[model samples]
Target: MPGTTTLWRPTGPAELDLVAASGWREWPPRLPEQPIFYPVLNVDYAIKIARDWNVPHSGAGFVTEFDVDTDFVSRYPVQQAGGRDILELWVPAEELPEFNRHIVGTIRVTHTFPETA
Candidate 1:
């Protein structure tokens, strides 16, 4: 992991299932309406999205962490969506396969949020 940067992703159950289906090695292709595959730079931002957004909208949420080659990820500049900690990298959909190649290790589900009554 020396040459890699750790990244966190906020995932809904459907997407988490897909990642699991890949044996935790790859991210599924973006859907037609989805243009970019974004991974956040911080776990806190990832957790916020998973807890506040994905849970309400998707009924379940997850936070995943993985490492990507620093050189490959550096091609996309870090984007700050709102606040200082809201940082992410936006990889175009078409480049995702190549981006997947730069992933250094298996993805892990660090946290999971299930629907609550």
Candidate 2:
């Protein structure tokens, strides 16, 4: 079956950077070669993983856009005593099932804080 497009909350700063750096200003980009890491509670660990796997030519890990309106807040709640904000990102249709299979899926995720109170 064809995969459905959906949005998921990224787990850390590294995932966030990957999204930003993807240059996907509009509707996220399709990451073919990239491998996402999921359930990544630690932003630092995510960053380190990105740094370690970031090849000069392959581009960052795979990222894409969701067809439906995502409920990021409901999916990933804020952690660390309100020091951070929780958000979700796009997961490719092709790899959705496999991504779910893994315990801590290797999907890219990022965190962003609100500017205003």
Candidate 3:
């Protein structure tokens, strides 16, 4: 079966800034307060997966993967909208099964960018 994918819409510029600064070193505080909502997977995971897949980095300090369809965003509408589409990150095949089993339909991953230096 094809893997599932999720669409993530960042809450705001602040959230985007947080992700850019941290590079997924840790989850940002702006993330929604709900266990069912799983914040975006660390960007480092994306970097590692891209390298493992032999994908080239654009030298932008960040990379995104897509078409694997292993992620799913919550259908719950945002209370207040307006944010940037930073990039679509993909989950690897090996990890997809685990994500499916544990996180696929149970949580919504929120994105929050921390303050920059």
Candidate 4:
């Protein structure tokens, strides 16, 4: 793990299914309308989106964490989309295949929405 960085991605059930179908090794390619594949820098940011947005819109949500080769991911600069904590890397849709190849290990679900209430 020395040359790797961990990233989090908030995903819906459909995307999660695709990830599972990949044997949890890689992410699925983005759809034509999707222009970028974004992975957040922190767990808090990932949790917020998965709980507040994905659950509401897609009926379920999850926060996934994975490691990627640091050098490979360095190609894209970190993007601060909103608050100081809202940090993410935007990999162009076309480059996601290459991005997937850089994943260091299995993707894991760190959190899931709709907690017992």
Best by TM-score: 1
Q: Which residue runs of candidate 1 sit more than 4 Å off their true CA positions?
A: none
Compose the digit string of candidate 3's lDDT tens values, residues 1-117.
Answer: 656554332233343356446553222442234333222334544344333332232212223222223434323232321234223333343443344343333222232223333
lDDT by residue (37-61, candidate 2, tens digit) is 2333345543443444442223453
lDDT of each: 0.95, 0.36, 0.35, 0.94
For candidate 4, write residues 6-36 as lDDT tens digits.
Answer: 9999999999999999999899999989999
For residue 2, what is the lDDT in candidate 1? Answer: 54
Look at candidate 1 and tell me the lDDT of residue 13: 91
Which is the winner by lDDT between candidate 2 and candidate 4?
4
TM-score of each: 0.97, 0.26, 0.25, 0.95
Candidate 1: count the clashes. 0
* Alpha carbon lDDT at 95, candidate 2: 47
> How high is the lDDT of residue 89 in model 4?
98
> Listing every candidate in turn, what is its Cα RMSD in Å to the true structure after a full C-alpha superposition?
1.0, 12.0, 13.0, 1.6
Candidate 1: global Cα-lDDT? 0.95
